[model samples]
Target chain A: DTAVSQTPKYLVTQMGNDKSIKCEQNLGHDTMYWYKQDSKKFLKIMFSYNNKELIINETVPNRFSPKSPDKAHLNLHINSLELGDSAVYFCAIGWGNTIYFGEGSWLTVV
Target chain B: GESVGLHLPTLSVQEGDNSIINCAYSNSASDYFIWYKQESGKGPQFIIDIRSNMDKRQGQRVTVLLNKTVKHLSLQIAATQPGDSAVYFCAALRAGNNRKLIWGLGTSLAVNP
Candidate 1:
């Protein structure tokens, strides 16, 4: 019973390549979020979806797009990835005042 | 454009000792706060949270203290064990219509045996 899960625990691709990371939550939460943790361990909010509606879109670049097919799933798609995009992408589900995070997807662009 | 940050990036403590991690947030409108623990390869895990009305909240062996006047928050772990060694982050949620949480750069805790 994994509450929140993200696929492709590790992703390695060459520069200029495009990829996607899938996420799902079984917690039946109404809100989902995508966060990026850089090499310096700074966690930044990228996007958030509430009931499949885009709620928050931070200063994320246009290359990063988040799609929510339903209340239980939110996926991140990156176009023309760059070396600076290499970091850990985390998906989370919010429950009232608390948020549960996935294991995280590590993306490395060479 | 408020930022949440930590006083120290890393802290080391011996087993059975109490550990305190400090965080400073610039947003006065933040009404909710949470503490998360992240292990080496895992994402941050929820620990405890506090509301702006309350200055302190406790859960199990963890306690969260909030100082609204100075816009500071601290997470204190009692009798820290090796299992508690992880990176901890403090996040704040704005008070109004939106519920987006602003996260701070984490503090890595190392519990020495």
Candidate 2:
């Protein structure tokens, strides 16, 4: 019974291929976010959705798209993956700025 | 210009010892602070949090101290055990319509038995 869970815990794909990472939260949170952690362990926010509405979209590339079909789910799709896109992606759910994170999905673009 | 950083990259402590990890933030608008523990090959886990109005908050065996004047935040763990070994991160959360959460570089803590 995890509060937050993500699919494709580890994925290896060729460059230019497309892939998606899915996330869901059972904590009844109104806000969900996607954060990318680089090799340096620097966590950068990519997108934030509140009640399935796009709230905060960072300066990420257009190839990276986030979709929230409902408040419980948020999925990220990356097109034309690059070597620089190889990093751990985290899904977080929260309300009022306090967050709970998923186990993380490691994406490796070769 | 907005960033959160840790003072040390790594920290080592013996079992039963107290551990202190420090962080500094440049954004004065941030009104909330949080500490997270990320174990190897796992996502970060929330540890503790404090508000700008409070100077200190404690949870279980962990304590978070916030110094708004100096923009410093510290997490203190009592009776550090090997299980407590992980990378600790401090994040600053700005309150308002624009929700920007700034994360620190993280401090790796190794507790020896």
Best by DockQ: 2
Q: Give fnat, all candidates.
A: 0.69, 0.67
DockQ per model, Cα: 0.68, 0.70
Tell me the tens digit of each residue's lDDT in model 1 across B1-113. Answer: 78888899999999999999999999887778889899999988889999988999999999999999999999999999999999999998764324677888889999999
Worst ten in a row by lDDT for model 1 chain B = B93-102
| Tens-place lDDT digits, model 2, residues A17-74 | 9999999999887888999999989999999988888989999999999999888999
After superposition, candidate 2 runs with Cα above 4 Å error: B96-98
Q: How well docked is model 2, in DockQ terms?
A: 0.70
TM-score of each: 0.95, 0.96
A57-110 per-residue lDDT for model 1 (tens digits): 989899999999998999999999999999999998877766778999999999
CA displacement after TM-score superposition, residue B103 of candidate 2 (Å): 0.6
Backbone clashes under 3 angstroms, per model: 0, 0
Candidate 2 chain B least-lDDT 10 residues: B92-101
